[model samples]
Target: MAKRKFKKQIYRYECTMTGEAFKTTREAPNPNDLVSVKAYYELNPDEDDRPEEIKKQLQTEE
Candidate 1:
């Protein structure tokens, strides 16, 4: 078998209070929950170039 490389997506999140920048592979569940948003930054992040996370909650509503 041959080796294969998979590209993992990275996301950037911010803490509305501290104004900190963080990176994560998955979207933050309940991004509106500002408390959880701050907690996300407490975790470790990947060391690769990743795209920024976009919040589309406002656009999806009719």
Candidate 2:
């Protein structure tokens, strides 16, 4: 007797920004599975500078 092999199928998706593509399985993704993709543009300052920076910004806004 001989055993048989099965072929699995795959699905793919693309990112709107970079036009880069990737693959996925399980047919379709659920609404909850989708993630928000955002870019990080802010940098953390030194610990001492953080408090003063926040205070200055708030005071200027007032």
Candidate 3:
């Protein structure tokens, strides 16, 4: 049997108010890496806009 490969995805998020950025990697990000990447999301609800922006940027690139 052939081995299946798990691809690592890079996700980036920026704060809408401060322009601060966060980044991380995951094998398969759920809700999105921006939402699940770290514990910061739980602490800062306002920074959750990155997922949709990242999705849009990815779509545009492809």
Candidate 4:
């Protein structure tokens, strides 16, 4: 068994918990070190898929 190393590429990412954005090296940081988007989707699989679904709801509400 061996460990996989991630490429160091600078990019902006948001803190899912604080809503604060910043730049970092890793493309996919450790979920334990940060937050997991997959957790939210797994917990609420049926929730609206954001801007698209949310926009549709607003249009229907108009």
Candidate 5:
């Protein structure tokens, strides 16, 4: 099926000065706004749910 878009979704952003990356569903700050994000992208959770990785981690910890 074709991908779908949601009104509010996770967005990944990087710090212009620190290059630190973070994700949030709230509105992302502009590239040069106070938070100083250098770049960002929509992080659709469905595209990378990684169920296998989660299952493996859970098994290892058990």
Candidate 6:
């Protein structure tokens, strides 16, 4: 069996200076044109996401 891939099916954008939403997909601004951009996604929900505690022995070496 082969794994599958997913892509973003939808996107939206607004003007940075005017605060108006774009009316059409073709009119949306490039991400670089915006003052700031934010992307959202999920990662490894079943596993611990934080770094493991450093052992005292290794900490002293650094």
Per-model CA lDDT versus the true structure = 0.55, 0.50, 0.57, 0.62, 0.56, 0.44
Q: Can you give the TM-score per candidate against the true fold?
A: 0.44, 0.36, 0.32, 0.30, 0.36, 0.26
lDDT per residue (tens digit) for residues 1-62 in model 2: 89888777887665544455666765655533433231111222333344668768756995
Full ranking by lDDT = 4, 3, 5, 1, 2, 6
Best by lDDT: 4
Regions of candidate 4 where Cα sits further than 4 Å from its true position: 1-8, 29-62
Q: Which candidate should be chosen as best, given TM-score against the real structure?
A: 1
Model 1 ranges with Cα > 4 A deviation: 34-62
Model 5 C-alpha lDDT versus the unseen true structure: 0.56
Q: In candidate 6, residue 5 scores what lDDT? A: 88
Off by over 4 Å in 5: 1-8, 34-62
* Candidate 1 per-residue lDDT over residues 1-62, each given as its tens digit: 99899999997777665666767899888655443342443342443223443223423551
Error of 1 at 59 (Å): 41
Task: Give Cα distance to truth, residue 33, candidate 3, Å.
Answer: 15
Summarize candidate 5's per-residue lDDT along 1-62 as a digit string, tens digits: 99887677777876665577777777654754424322222234345445688757755995
How displaced is residue 55 in candidate 4, in Å? 42
| lDDT (tens digit, per residue) of candidate 4 on 11-45 | 77665665656676667645335544544544676
Candidate with the larger TM-score of 1 and 4: 1
TM value for model 6: 0.26
lDDT of 6 by residue, 2-61 (tens): 988865445566656546554433434465465321111113334433344633444477
Cα-based lDDT at residue 17, candidate 6: 54
